[model samples]
Target: MRTTLDFTPLFRSSIGFDRMLNALEAASRVETIDNWPQYDIAKFGEDDYRITMAVAGFSQNELTITQEQNMLMVSGQKAGEDEGQYLHRGIAERVFRRRFELADHVKVVGASLVDGLLTIDLKRELPEEMKPRRIEIATGEKLPRAGTKQIETGKQAA
Candidate 1:
């Protein structure tokens, strides 16, 4: 069964969340998206994540990883044609492209391919200005005296 969601209500009340809502809506609309080359997303730490993809018949030269803004794209295309005739072929030998939407502050640190598995590491590095900070509050008794004299001006009044 297929279902459609109405985001009109959410758009009316929410502010500055258009990107998030659009991503959610796009994900929901693509019900029959391809699931080839199985993948796994795991979190090792609070802000560290890894994406592992099973690319059995693909090589490092045939795969490409790109990052644009907040989107990460991984694509693979087999090079050259099969030389020998196969009686029973089970492995998938086709081109595929996968996209991942990353949140703000999340960046692709590194990627490695070993034994048919492609692992991409991600880290969320928040800026110093955006990190949590403590604000100091002054007590009532520590307030400046209202009767304090103002600094005298160097110029003489006419």
Candidate 2:
């Protein structure tokens, strides 16, 4: 049984969170999709992440990895190979496409395929402007403008 959630109320009160809400909706809808070619997401460091997928019998040439906006797509299609004759085949040789939603500032650094496992590396690189900064606070009273004559408060001239 599939249940649909209503986010109208949540959306009405939230601001600048449209992407997060959309991602939640998309995640809820992906339950019915095929789960072939299992994968794993692991975080090594504070800003470093890695995604590994099991892609047995898939060559590097037959696989493609693409990034569009905040979406990362990994697809693989095995080329038809002749095995002479098989009485009973159990291994799956099907095409698969997997997508991962990346957060803002997260970028794909590199990818490698070894021993039938495809590992994709990701790093979060925050812009200099967005990074934490220190603001200097004024300690003393405000200074007077330059080239301006200060009037004596105690004695006033007529």
Q: Clashes per prediction?
A: 0, 0
User: Candidate 2 local accuracy as lDDT?
Assistant: 0.91
Model 2 per-residue lDDT tens digits across residues 31-147: 666788999999998999999999988989999999998999999987778667989877777888899999999999999999999999999999999999999887887966689
lDDT of 1 by residue, 61-91 (tens): 9999999989999999999989999999999
Which candidate ranks first by lDDT, i.e. highest? 1
State the lDDT at 136 in candidate 2: 86
Error of 1 at 78 (Å): 0.9
Task: Report, for every candidate in turn, its global Cα lDDT versus the true structure.
Answer: 0.94, 0.91
For residue 129, give model 2's deviation from the true position in Å. 1.2
All candidates: TM-score: 0.83, 0.83
Quality of model 1 by C-alpha lDDT: 0.94
Among residues 3 or more apart in sequence or in different chains, the pairs in candidate 2 whose N, CA or C atoms overlap within 3 Å are: none
Worst 10 residues of 2 by lDDT: 26-35
